[model samples]
Structure formats: C-alpha cells, structure tokens
Target: MSEIVTTRQQTPGDLQRLDEAPTPAEYLGRMLSDRPALRIGTRTSPMAMAQAGTVQRLLDERAGVASEIVGISTSGDQWMGDLSKLGGKGAFLKQIERALVMGHVDIAVHAMKDVPGDVPLAEGTALAAYLPREDVHDVLVVREGSKYRSLDEMPPGTRIGTSAVRRKAQLLKHRPDLHVDRLRGNVNSRIAKLDAEAQFEAIVLNASGLRRTGLEHRATEVLSTDIMCPPVGSGVVGVQCRTADTAIAEALRLLDDPMTRTLITAERTMLHGLQGHCNSPIAGHATMTGDGQLSLKGMVFTREGGKFAYAQEWDAPDRAAELGAYVAAVLLRKGARGIIDGIPH
Candidate 1:
C-alpha cells in the first residue's frame, strides 16, 4: 500500500506569517516558473497530511506536475473538545475552504467523510477530483489480552468507545448488550489510550484511517459494512479548487477516479437529501457495479435507539444523484423522516 510521505509539523517560523504567504497569482507564477510546483492546502495532522501527500503524488504522476504541501490549522484542529457541541461538521472544513476561497492555496485536500454533505463552495469553486475509495468498514482495536474480535463477540456490558453517534447507534442496534462510551484524539493517541488504560475494552475506528497510518496491525476485526454502513464518503480523498482555475482543475482531473466519484455522489446526495449532519446518526454507502450502474445502501437511526430505517436503490451512472435522492425518499417513507426529524443536530 502506498503511504503519505509528508509529516504534519509546525511550519518553520519563516513560513508562518501571512505576509510570507504569496498571492494566488504569485503562487501560480511560481508553478509556471523555471521550477514548477503545485501547492496543496491541508489540515496539519499526521493522518490528514498523509492523505494530502498521497493526492499530491498522484497529481504529480498523472498530470506530469510536481507539487508541495502547505499545512494549515483548521477550526476542528484548534478546538478538539466537543465537535457536535461546537459548530457541527463545518468546524472541520470551514477554515480550509476559506483558505481556498481567499487564494491562500491552489488546491485543498480533504477526507470525504469529514466534509459535510451540503458544502456551499462559491459557485466557481468545487471538488476537483475524487481518489480511489479504500476499505469502508469500521474496525475494533481491542486492548491486548482481550478476546473480542467482532462487535458481536464482545460480551454483555463490554465497554466500547467511539465519538460518532452514527457508529454508536449502529453498534447498539445490533448489540444493545454492549456499552458505548465517548472517545476522542488522533489515531495514535486513541490507540495508546486504549492500550494504556482500562477505560474501554475496545475502540472503533475507520479501517481507512488505520490503513493510512500503517497501523493495520491493531485491527482486531473489520466490522462488515453490512452491519456498519460507513459514513458518507468514508474512504475517499477529494480535492477542492476554484472552478475558474481551469488549468488546476484539469490538472486535478487526471487524479479523479470516475467510479469512486459516481458512488460518492450518490452517497453524498442521500445525506444531503436527508439533511443529515455529523450530529445525526446517519450512515450511507454507494457502490459502482461491474455493469456500470450505481447501487446505494443507507441507514438512519434515532439517538435513543428506538427507531431505525434502511434503504437501497440502483440506477445508471448518469443518474447517481437521482438514485441517492430516490433511496433517501424510500427511507423517508419507511419512517426515516421521523428518525431524521427527531434526532438532535
């Protein structure tokens, strides 16, 4: 597996000042200079920068363009206390998007799941490319000497940790017998906490995160997407850029995975249609079939675990957005509306 080569570290003092930051024109001038380089904006986290580097490399290879990264601090990174209790999913992405809009950087790379379903980029700004999707399942990283492999394998009253209401709702729906507790921190920190303390018997993390960090050794079991439908666009990478910048857009377009984008469009459309946010216990996944059609699957559940609904739909690639809306409507008719409306945002 290819890994992200860049590390997330504080920018050297020389590069920290905005006065030191070049204008969009200046940056593009540098790119078209005798030594060309594309600049990608990303949050300053090991996992995030790693993902950014992966995209940078792909853009370099496929577009015949060299690139470098500019690590930026996002609101989500500054205030890690309570995501939902703060300002919702937008906290994770707003600053980064603002940087793009302000021309601080030419491109922005993001984890698709962290991005909200209804991102309101300026009319001329859009997701430039979608990378190949990785494994979309959740995984249980159990404490050493623990016998639990799958979520079901955990005993009654077993304490599990997770920050996502969607994962908590889904896990409880299947195994109400287990205990779900709150968890926070970067990937390595979470694992260290779980390993060093007895607060939780295990913690649930995205398989893609583990794989990206080269920590797959900790996975006790990969929870099937069947039981744990992934959050929208869980394992994909998306690059955002100004729509008017046709050269940069075309450069990024080379890294776009058509199948991945088609599937993510359906999943994101379903999320947008349901008016779902990170606070809402919603999970959706869409797959592109061999025959070139898109198949969608999704679930919406209540916070109290009282009500739940699932829906699946299929359509040709061209109708990806329509397919997602139809599936959401189906789930809505089957009591999903009640669950969505009742859930706290």
Candidate 2:
C-alpha cells in the first residue's frame, strides 16, 4: 500500500498533475489484481443515508466499484439550536470531513446545500464530483387537510417553521404578516412536529429532501423560484475525496453531471463572492439555456426582511464563475452590502 499523504495547501502544479493522472479503473487494473472496496462517510440521518446510497449505487454502476456505507455523527446533528450559531452549514460537515481527511473513509457524500460557500476542506481533500441534481425548489408542507394551498393563500399571522435565514427572510418579504419561527431536525422529526404539535401552520423544506426520503407527498405546494429562490447548490449531492487518491477521485468523477456541476459552480461562486454564509439571507440559482448560455439570479435580504436586493446575469457556460461574481457585484451596488454585513457570524 502507498503511504498516505496529508497536505493542506494545494498548488496549481498539484492540480495539473492530478489532471494528468490515469483514471481510477486504468490505475487499479495496472497496480492491483484485487479490487478495493470503498467506505463512504455520511451523517447518520435518514436523509443523509439515502443520499449516500445514491452515490454508492452510482459508483457501482459507473465504475464497477464495491462500497460500504459508514454513518458518522456530526456537530450539526447534535446541536439543537440555530444552525447559524454553530458556524452555518459547515457544522454538519466537519466530523464527516475529519473522517475522510484522517483516512477513516475513502469518500464523503454531502447534500450540496449544506456545503459551505467557502469550503474548509481538510488537507488534500477536494470535491470530486456532483451527482445529477434533484428538484431545486423549496416546498411548503402544511398539516394534512389544511385549507392553505400556498404561501400567498395562507392567512395573515400564519406561523411557518424553518431554520434557514434565507427562507425566513423571503417568506417575510413575500408576506410580512406570516410568522417565521425556528424549526430544526431531520425531515421526519420536523414533519412529525408539524403534524402532532400544530405549532406551525406550515414549514419550509427543501423539495429534494422530501423526494429523497420518499415523502414528497407531504409537500402541499412547491414554492416557485419567483417566490423563494433556493440556496446555492441546493438540489445536488457532492462527492468528496482526497485529491492525492487519484483512483478514488477518478472513480467519483464518473458520476459527475456536467450541467449540474456548471449550475452549482455559478451559484456557489456567487455566494463565495458575496461572502455569505448559511446564516446570511442569501439565495442564488443558475440555469443553463438551450443555446449554452448560463443565467444566474441571486438575492440578499436584510436580517429583519425589511429590505432586500436582487440581481441576475447571463454568460457563456464556461464563464459561470464570472457570471456569479458579476451578479454579486450588481447586488452589492444595489445596497446589498448593508444587509449582508449586518448578519451575525
């Protein structure tokens, strides 16, 4: 076996070398007669397990790789309070990432939206690929038999539970009378609370999560992007691996969907340029046109939802990151800086 290498900073030369390396199958055939089984690391939540299963299946089909699922608990899972207070979306990722960096697992699967805009990857680790995306819209899950069909139709002062600052701000912007309360837990727990306690009229959840968990029927209405733009990288699953492990990285690349990667790059680039975290009321989405141009739309809102700014841009697909940065600049010029700067760390 090769000695494991761990290095934090990657140079341009290192990336060039990896690009020149052989594909996983090619390398494996030449170096080892026996195929190595991989261990995939993920959070223990049912939704996380389902996502990991997707990646496992993809690897098996695409690269003829064998793998085992390894569930890992994270700080984000243990914390019961606001995610914002725990350093945003990355909280859910730290422990899983540690296992990957320490070689306890060969791969880390993540809900792309939970990946921080500024990813703090362990030494030598990189996001190798993205799976085909799921629905990129937010949905309103009202208690079964509720008369409310959508956010606009809900009665004034209707309480909606959600931990996402982006959802809370947008819901308030659309209907100032709606009460936004903090709601945290896995998909099942939140739904159970909504059904049994009746503390909230509805709750906002990612449509992809519901679909992944086989609970899509729970969503009363899929909120359109017009009403609620999704957070950056919302509907995708990212596969992370050590960059030094070219075999694993190449195998994961077999699952990468080019269009999904392009869209998420633009969205994440926009978030990175704006210096926004999960706590910030930031939302962005990118789409590829039939003509090959990429369109990016982004929004930033005041913490209180009293004010907001939005911007959009279109460019060649190859210029996705540039388009994201351009949109961020446009929003900043429209006084979005005040709103973003005011968010608590």
Q: In angstroms, how far off is 260's CA in candidate 1?
A: 0.7
Reference-based lDDT, each prediction? 0.83, 0.87
Q: What is the C-alpha lDDT profile of model 2 across 1-345, one tens digit per residue?
A: 999999789999999998989776656534422645799999999899999999988877777778899999999998988887788788999999989989999999999888888756678899999998889999999986678878878888899999788899988888898889989999989999999999998999999899889999888888889988998888899999999988788778878999898998899888888887667888999998788789999999986578999898899999888898899899889988888778777
Top-TM-score structure, candidate number? 2
Q: Cα lDDT of model 2 overall?
A: 0.87
Which regions of candidate 1 are displaced past 4 Å? 1-36, 290-292
Tens-digit lDDT track of model 1 for 1-345: 998798776666745785678655445445555544767999887888899989877865566567889999877777757787667777878888888888888899999988887656555789989999998989989987787777767789999989788889888888888889878777887888898998999999999899888899999888888778899989998999999888788778778988899889899889888877567888999987788778999899987455789888789898998999999899888988777777665
Candidate 2 Cα deviation (angstroms), residue 214:
0.7
TM-score of each: 0.87, 0.89
